[model samples]
Target: MRRTSSKYVRHSDEGELLWLRPPTRSGHVFIKVDPTNTSSARMAMGTQQVEVGGRIPVHRHDSQDEILFVYAGQGTVIVGDERAQFKAGTTVFIPQGVWHGVENTSDEPLQVVWVVSPPGLEAMFRDIGTPPGEEAKSLTPEEFAAVAERHGMRVKSH
Candidate 1:
């Protein structure tokens, strides 16, 4: 079995975010570590740092389940039909193929360790991701569906 911590492998050597697709998000810094470079063979971990009022819009992993561990600050997680409040030490599990997003609602930045089983699919999101400065504020009902359809990701609204 492998042995390592992504926290150590993906951190910045120069005090900036590292090991993610790119620094294209204004509020988020994501570092994804999978079996190839991490210890968990059946899991992928992404360390995320998001500033206040920042968020990842509702999205889903078509083939993976996810667990979000709140390490600091306050946030809200919209999972399927419900929006749950979270704080440090909170853990939320999101089953596969459901829509979800994490929003930093506190005054301080939010930190979360997202665990995705059997690797994750954010690479595709990265590919289609709008750069930080070009991100959309919010999508209309039809617009949201179109975006997901373009990526072949189904948008589920409970």
Candidate 2:
């Protein structure tokens, strides 16, 4: 048997929002489901809007597997050294320890929805991302890598 909860919903703008700075990627990360909002949730879910020409640098989650769904726009994705073009409706699975990254190649922003199992990557975004409306703070590549490492991710150097 599985536990159950009453129906719940989260609007597009109802979740926690964070702004990522350079050295990683300039984008808006919206964390919709995580321990903070759904204690029983076993996975973390969120959406990211990557600015034109911006990219999510190469990185790997050592402890969690991730699934990314391209919701809108187009982009190129690298998974373990293999690159592929992805558009709306494309889904990619990234196993734990596999290096992967996404680059927005289209003129419009690349919209992606990501889910990670074992729940926790949300903490990294919360720690490093600047709150919307606040002056975006910058982090050096090394500093960013350090923060990522603390959260079970290894970011490739730029």
Output the number of the TM-score-best candidate.
2
Q: lDDT of each prediction vs. the true structure? A: 0.64, 0.87
Residue pairs whose backbone atoms clash in candidate 2: none
User: Of the candidates shown, which would achieve the greatest lDDT relative to the real structure?
Assistant: 2
What global local distance difference test value does model 2 have?
A: 0.87
Residue lDDT tens for model 1, 108-156: 9888888777664444344434434454344454555565566545655
Query: What's the C-alpha lDDT at position 7 in model 2?
Result: 27
TM, every model: 0.64, 0.92
The lDDT, on a scale of 0 to 1, for candidate 1 is 0.64
User: Residue-wise lDDT of candidate 2 within 18-61, one digit each (tens)?
Assistant: 99989768988998888766766689988999999999999999
lDDT for 153 (candidate 2): 96
Task: List candidate 2 stretches off by more than 4 Å.
Answer: 1-7
Q: Tell me the TM-score of model 1.
A: 0.64
